[model samples]
Target: MEEQFYLVWPPVLLLLLSLGRRRRTLVLGLSTVVVAASAASWLSYRTPSGGSTPDVYFSPVLGVVPLATGCVLALLLDDERCRSFASGLAGHLGTWAGAAAVVGVQFWIGDDWTDHAWTFGLLMPATGLAAAVLIGGLVSVRTPVSVALSWSPVAWFGRRVSYSAYLWHPLVIALLGTFAIGWFGNVWLFAAAVIVSIGAAYAIEVPVEKLRARVREARRLVAEDHAARSAAAS
Candidate 1:
């Protein structure tokens, strides 16, 4: 069956825009959007192209619920007095709890990601919570893990090869499958794809980053000079 992602995106966008508005209005708007999203997802699932499963039908609803709720929580609970508590809750307990929930749910559902167990159930909310925690932690950390991870072999090479490999790996996979190379097993197929992706990133992407960095630095320097000149004139 052909996949179309627009089914999931529109309602999420509406919910995001409704954040920070009046509670009554926001709640009404979000409720409407959620129902619409759920219905659309379900209809898409029931359509002849796809099989009927509650998970597939309700995937978009699952993702938007946490986002809408969090926005509401942030708006309604915007309290200076609770800052410390919110920080602590977000950092230590929230991040790990959400991650564990995802791992647990995956195990329970037998690791079926596409059929909707991963998309609609615990995975989406867990992802949102994990993102919130990671962002919070990164903001607070004196020396961020990004710095460490950036230099790690996995990250460095992964970032470098991610682009060309991402673009070309699909074609490579299609070719391999067409040629009956998949007889080796799915693991080998995946491994071969990864190796190809990394090779492409290493060979094509690292050099492009150098040019991109230089351009960015030049722009920064120009902006700094303009600021200095304005200060001098003032």
Candidate 2:
């Protein structure tokens, strides 16, 4: 059934495109049909049948295709009032709904959510689109300073060596556990990993970034000098 739909979708989409008067409705309806078909393919999947393997195409198909389709429809409308209304409506629903679902699921699952890496990967692009729209709407009137203030903590943590901590902390905890340490509970292990991560960040990663920046600047200066000498000769 999935294979049949997958094969047929292209022809159906082309048929929809041929309909001039109902293009927007047909495009949107076809997009929804595709989303539902794709989602059904996901939900009914069986691990034994190679369904559990991570699908990298999920986000591009589910998130990006719909967005592109909507934008195409807006452009086809070509009227300011219609475009504005459509954009606003679509932006509100997509951004708010996607962000809310991701946040809600994260809260519900907590640390365990990372175990289902494939599911999270599928949702992330949609979540990103939502975040982009939400941030765009908020920043339209605000200063960059205000936007930076709003985003600083999240930005800092995302750029930090938190991933290094996440990657290595399990090994550290396992080693500690091997020693039969009763005191190394989740809280203690987590705190210890954080301390080690911070130390590593300051001692190693910061220095590496500084060295890379220095090298880049040195190359830029050398290039500038060469350019200046060539210009002088000319």
lDDT, model 2: 0.55
The whole-model lDDT of each prediction reads 0.55, 0.55
User: Measured by C-alpha RMSD in angstroms, how accurate is candidate 2?
Assistant: 9.9
- Candidate 2 lDDT by residue in tens digits, 55-101: 43344444444344444443344555544544565544544554566
TM-score for each predicted model, relative to the true structure: 0.48, 0.45
Q: Which candidate tops lDDT?
A: 1
For model 1, how does the per-residue alpha-carbon lDDT over 41-102 read when each residue is reduced to its tens digit? 44444322253345453454555655554554454345443345545545445445544554
lDDT of 2 at 17: 61
